[model samples]
Target: MPKSKVRKKTVYTPPSSDRTTTPVKLAGPTHPVYIAVMLGMMLIGLAWLVVNYLAGNSIPFMATLGPWNFLIGFSLIVIGLLMTMRWR
Candidate 1:
């Protein structure tokens, strides 16, 4: 009769002693024009809400013409200004 040998498995783990931390810094110009445009659009939206409330005209067309148009126009104007400035 032959005797059988049993083998044991070993688990490996990485050392956690070596660690590095780096601080992240964001880079970009804080454009005042963009802020102004956003504020203007918000004001326009507020005005539209006020006008709708006062007039009692619950027309869907006003939604498209009032705040929506202001947002689109404001966005376009801001983008155009940014492009002209060439801020990269």
Candidate 2:
């Protein structure tokens, strides 16, 4: 029987580049007000939609705004959702 040959493996090295030595500042915890505002926006948006659906024809402002009510509700919800990304 013939003896099998062993294969040699090369060590892997990462490519080096010009990286800054300065340490990055870590972000602090999100402020309580920020969390409140974020939650408030989402809740307000949902409430707005609910109000529009429930009393759009009866409420003067909602009736006047008409389709714009949807925009306001969705915009608030979107703003709140965007804020979540920055939440700690």
Candidate 3:
């Protein structure tokens, strides 16, 4: 087998410090209603799963949904978690 040739690495160049940048505006705190909705989604998802497990067969609509109930429940939770990324 032939040995591979070694290549020289390029030198790192520092950026020029002469560029002026505008100050970034800081975002205000998230609204109380937004927090409430985010928390509500997660709580609702948990409640949905609990209800599905506890009485899935008893509820007419829940019985019809069958396995889809799991999807709906998990989706709500994931959406709520995603919303938290923008909360600040």
Q: What is residue 7's positional error in candidate 1, in angstroms?
A: 38
Candidate 2 residue 59 Cα shift, in angstroms, is: 0.5
Give candidate 1 regions above 4 Å deviation: 1-17, 27-29, 56-88
Residue by residue across 14-70, what tens digits does model 2's lDDT show?
889778688889999999999999999999999999999999999998999999999
The pairs that clash in candidate 2 are: none
Clashes of 2: 0
Better of 1 and 3 by TM-score: 3
lDDT of each: 0.61, 0.97, 0.97
- In the range 1-88, model 3's lDDT, one tens digit per residue, is 9999999999999988999989999999999999999999999999999999999999999999999999999999998999999998
Q: lDDT for model 3, please.
A: 0.97
Q: Against the hidden true structure, what lDDT does model 2 obtain?
A: 0.97
Error of 3 at 1 (Å): 44
lDDT of 3 at 86: 90
